[model samples]
Target: MQLQTIVPIKPLGNPINYKAKIVNIGSCFAVNMAQRLQYYQFQNTINPLGILFHPEAISRLLEFVVNDKVFTQEDVFQHNEIWSCFDAHSDLNQLEQEDIIEQLNSKICRFKANVFDATHIILTFGTAWVYRNKQSNQIVANCHKVPQNQFEKELLAVETCLENLKKIEQNLRQINPNIQIIYTISPVRHIKDGFVENQRSKAHLIAALHEYLEKNKPLNYYFPSYELLMDELRDYRFFGKDLIHPNDLAVDYIWQKFVETCIHSNEIPTMKMVDEVQKGLVHRSFNPYSDAHQQFLDKLAQKIDVLLEQYPFMNFR
Candidate 1:
């Protein structure tokens, strides 16, 4: 007797209209994806804190971008709350929690009220781990030198995470019921958790998330970000020196895959020079300092100078 093995296939939904505004949240990989979408001229916004509260620095970073100012390394670092150099002079931990909460509420309200009209929300879950504040009994974006042992412990169950996501969706759906949601898991490993534990944690998350996606209906979708990174580009060369995060090449590969799979077509708008550079990088022939490449760099510099002249608020110099 011959036996047939049946494979369950996910339904291929209708192609997403490229006209919608997209909001990306979650991890650094989500940030990379957002950047590519913005480069391609899609109406896109990236929430640096994901579902968490926004920091003051992130607001300033968005202000700079909206004004067409050139973003500097310092600006990026500040936006992400990395204070290695400046921490010596300032007690970043002393920033008022109430003020942060107010700012975050204001921004979230604005997005929900004005930006949710025709938006697709893409959420990435980095990990189940979270740090709670002892004083308020609330989860925080960062621990900020607060004694870890003082806080009550909680690891977000998959159900809790899914409920939070559904709440976010419901809030947006109030403004626009047609809103779509995409979920992805960050492939970047948390090496601080130790190799064996890290793998175990990721396995638990993936399994839980996959089960949730399978049970949920069409309003929510799961993108294979984890699979693409782990299965398609598993080579060590694709990762950075950290051996956790994807290097530039790997990032580009994932971005390209996203464009193909999610964006729907290659006809999306992109800067001509950026397109050229991307093609060069894909073929492994990009030389930033090359004479011909310098021409494009010069043009980009000229554009930046014009922007700097126009927006005196940006103090990149």
Candidate 2:
């Protein structure tokens, strides 16, 4: 009867609903959850600066948004003939200096706009280990394939992680005092850092995050994403071929748990309806001109029209 241990999750005080303005940031796992939110047609924005893996990188992003920092030629550099910014993920890189600068500034503007009105902000931290550029004496978000000799690898201390967490909260609250923050530690393991090293990194992040939550209380909520994967779904089957990232099935299971705890009960019907429409949209008709297929298309169109009528923000196209 008790084959597995469940990670008991409590219902959120201010659970997300159709009306909630959501913005997700941090690790690639955050993108997983954001994909689910997007599928359900929720008002969600994700990773404008791209996938930031550590707390300090996230803090730097928030600092840029809060301080209205402008990007210039000096902020970006060329490596392997591709221009990149040390403060952002490679997803934002471009072929020219002006293009990258413009892209970064544009994304920052978008992030600032969304965050100022965001009701719920989700942050997922991937590691405490970071690469500090020896020349700049600063931690970079992404190394961008730079030579390893140019950077110093170091583990961020618990105190520094805690400080970054607090600063993130303070900065967000300053922009939108009513914003509720949800924090989760990424479940993906960085085995390249070495097995023991990865464990130490996660421990530091977990300790610092919990300490910050315990001290600050309700402005922040901790979701045990790490525990759920490592404990509840403790099987190799739940992981991708890399044996690091959670597979699609595991992400679906975790997302279901997230819905049960963090999403509003009233929105379940809408979510189900959205799921149906999504599946119907992708359904293939074996016969191109069959009456049955036409009827199915009609039903799908009706569902889309109804949802769009109720939630104008939703786009089935």
Candidate 3:
């Protein structure tokens, strides 16, 4: 008997241009992608409040929105001042009742309300696993030093994830029905989890996300950051010493693939073009550096000069 192999669907053409206001949510990998977009002068927002790694942050955000509060960076810094507030001598209940925390909560609520107007919403799920507080019936972003034994647990179901995503989409659509949603599975490995478990976890997220995207059609799309890293550049050289996160070179490679697959579908631009684009936009001030670093910058400058000669368009002057 002959068996047929199923092939994955590839992205069809250049990314459709829409003057987009983008919001990125989920794991650290989302941060990396957001940085790349910002580098390219794309209007994008990645967690306006900052790194939201746990369930408490999510809940707090909702609470803030509902209450009509304004948040500043100082407020967030104060919230995360401790390593784990739940473990500290301070009273958790009292802290929750504080006026500042309440104010911060209101701000988060407003942010969520504003998100519905975003032109594009991008989410990257890091894991299916989540911590839950049984008594409170709420998701906890972090255990907050609560004893591992006492902290309740729940693994997010594929169905639950899909439902949540649908709700998020629905809410956004109410504000702007034409908004587009993009989902990506973060490629950064979870080193805290054992290697075997990490792989299993990633597989679960990817499978769930893939199925969800397929069922939803054009309203949602999946970007292949995970596949590009795991399949194309699987070598150790692409990873940092930590063995979990991609090194600078790996990130650049994945970014190139992203541009190729999503931004320019037909022809990949030359490295010289990439460099020229970067230099044209870079506004950083040069500082005195050691001989080695200076040498590297000097070589880069020379290459830029040569490329300018070859392609006069690269000369901003």
Candidate 4:
């Protein structure tokens, strides 16, 4: 008898090889996956505008980048000595408004380049609930600790999600005709939205995402990350202290499942070698002048040299 339910994930037609350039955008989970890809030294960019959680915010940001929409003074507001932009996350907030504008535009340049050049784009949507600034009537990526009354919180309609997906598809494909998009609903639960509301929000996302996939069959795909957490893990132990986010162990499990499903089989050996080099780089030496430690450093350098020779674009730093 089986003790656990397994999720059968089909490999993509065009696998991610060393040559594949990737960009991961959207929620914190996207950052989690991108860090793993970074560990293996894959050519990729992660959350250039920082961790955007909603489909509309991500959709708007992508549209801005592809259209070369630059941020200006009118776009940001000063809050408690820090300047913040509704278009981006708090990570871009700065002491000066001018500094924030410059930072936002610089990140946009990189995001635009990655949008055009990436072979694979992974987007993780964390919520369908969005907060719109009452004054501007625009969905804000983050509230930045502003008072609740300043914004109106509403669940994004299914049609609205569908529209954003179409906008993302149209804008991206217009530039990078061959780009492949992998959509994952983040496993992080928004319990603060209330239990029933959280389920309703996820329901909207799942329906909209699947509808988009069914209609636009060519370029989009979905990985059942939420399902994996809900079905396979199915325990409070898989959650962190807050109980809203997947714990490190759960994230690692999902990542390993992701590798087996999405990553090319041919690259596994390279991944193993990269892992060895990474572990060696972090290994602590008991004696700074010891011969054994010196030999270990030499071997680590040799492995790095071999990888560099094979993939000239890869850098350990």
Candidate 5:
């Protein structure tokens, strides 16, 4: 008897290889994929503006980057003795207004440069629920622990999200025509938004993503990450303590699926070698100066040298 239901996913037409430059934005789950890419020494840039959870937040950043818009002093606010901008996550919050403004603008410049050469751009949307700042009548990426009364909570309409996403895609393509775009709904559950509301949020995101992908068929792909988690790994054991986030095992399983579908077949051997090297680097030896351990180190060093000689950009460490 079959044990578990599997989600069918087709391999990407243009798979990402070592030569491909990749940029990932949106959602903390993007970090999971970016971390794997970093581990295997793939050319990857992730979330320059930080972990933005909604499409509005992501589109806002992309719009600013494409237009070369700079955040002025008025765009920032002082809250809890920290200077920060609502357009970016709390991670970018700084102590000085000048520091935050410079950081945001610098990140936008870096994003422009990165996307210009990116071979693949991956966007992960976490939620459709958004918070609109009452003061400026604008949606904010993160509230940064501000009082709940200061913002109006809202669910983004499918039409609004679809338009924003299209704008983002158009802006990105203008800067880099050859770049392939991938979209996925984050599997992380927003339980705090209430279970039914969370489902509603995901429904909107899924609808918008499918509509976008259908219209822009070429060079656009959608990986059913949300389906994979909800259908394939339906057990609560796959989630962390809060039962909202994917655990390490679940993340690894998703990453394996991601590689299976998105990575070039030719890169498998090199990935294996890299995995071996990574494992060796982290392996612990009981004897620090034994001849056998020394020989092992020498062999590991040789393996690293061989890989690095061909792919000079890859760093074993």
Candidate 6:
């Protein structure tokens, strides 16, 4: 007897292959998919500026890239001896003003180039809740651990989120008209936002996203990542220690589903070969100098060489 109800996924017409250049952005869950793609040796980029949880933060990033905006000292601030930009995650924060500005500009330049060349763009929206800086009256991507009183916490309305989604689409289409956009709601629970409030936040995001997808069907698709976790893997066992994020097993399950629907079937063999090489590369023999170990290393090298012969971009080093 079937124990779990599977989330039905429709295959994409233009499925991703080894040659596809993929850009993954948005919440932390985006990194999970990107990591899987990277392990398979696919061309992929993820959150160059940093993980952005909401649509407004994501839209602002795209706008900055499209407009070729340069980051200056005015765009960043100093707090607790760390220089951080309101537009970027704390991972990009630096100890000095010039360093942070340079880092932001560098990321923007790289991300802009990636967008122009991207064949597929995957966006994972995490929440509708956002924090706006009281002084600037602007929604900040991250507060950078500033004083709580400095920002006004707010939940974005469906209409406002929809506008940001449309803007994101417009900016992406402007850069590359043929790029396919795949959208998904992140499965990670924002328990800090309160259980009921978290559900409301997700409701607003889903409503707005569905509206946007309904209006722009061509070259746009929605993946049921949120449904997969909440409906199919509906158990606390799928969650991590914090009980908020999906554990590795859950991520792998969702990734397999993604592969079945989104990835080109022809790339499976190549992906398997890549996985073999990856596993062999990390293998350690007790006797490093043994003839058997040397032979194993030689065989691994040969496998790498064969793969590189066809896909020169597939670097095992």
Q: Candidate 3, residues 184-220: lDDT per residue as tens digits?
A: 7777887676677677777767766677667777667
Q: Give the TM-score of candidate 5.
A: 0.98
Clashing residue pairs in candidate 1 are: none
lDDT of 5 by residue, 160-231 (tens): 989988988998898998899989999999989999999999999999989988899899999888999999
RMSD of each: 9.9, 0.6, 8.1, 1.0, 0.9, 0.8
Clashing pairs in 6: none
Please give the CA lDDT of all the candidate structures: 0.56, 0.95, 0.59, 0.90, 0.93, 0.95
TM-score of 4: 0.98
Locate the minimum summed-lDDT window of 10 residues in model 4: 6-15
lDDT of 4 by residue, 1-317 (tens): 99889888877777789999998988988888898999999998988778999999889888888788888999899999999988888998999989999998899888888878899999899999999899888889999999899999999999999999999888888779899999999999999999999999999999999999998878677888899999998899999999889999999999998888889999999999999999988888889699999998999999999999999988787
Query: Model 6, 14-61: lDDT tens per residue?
Result: 899988999999999999999999999999999988999999999999
lDDT of 5 at 31: 93
Clashes of each: 0, 0, 9, 0, 0, 0
lDDT of 1 at 284: 35
- Evaluated against the true structure, the overall lDDT of model 3 is 0.59
TM-score, predicted candidate 1 vs. hidden true structure? 0.65
TM accuracy, model 6: 0.99
Q: Residue 114 of model 2: what lDDT?
A: 99
Q: Name the better of 3 and 4 by TM-score.
A: 4
TM-score of each: 0.65, 0.99, 0.67, 0.98, 0.98, 0.99
Off by over 4 Å in 3: 1-9, 12-18, 52-114, 144-150, 264-317
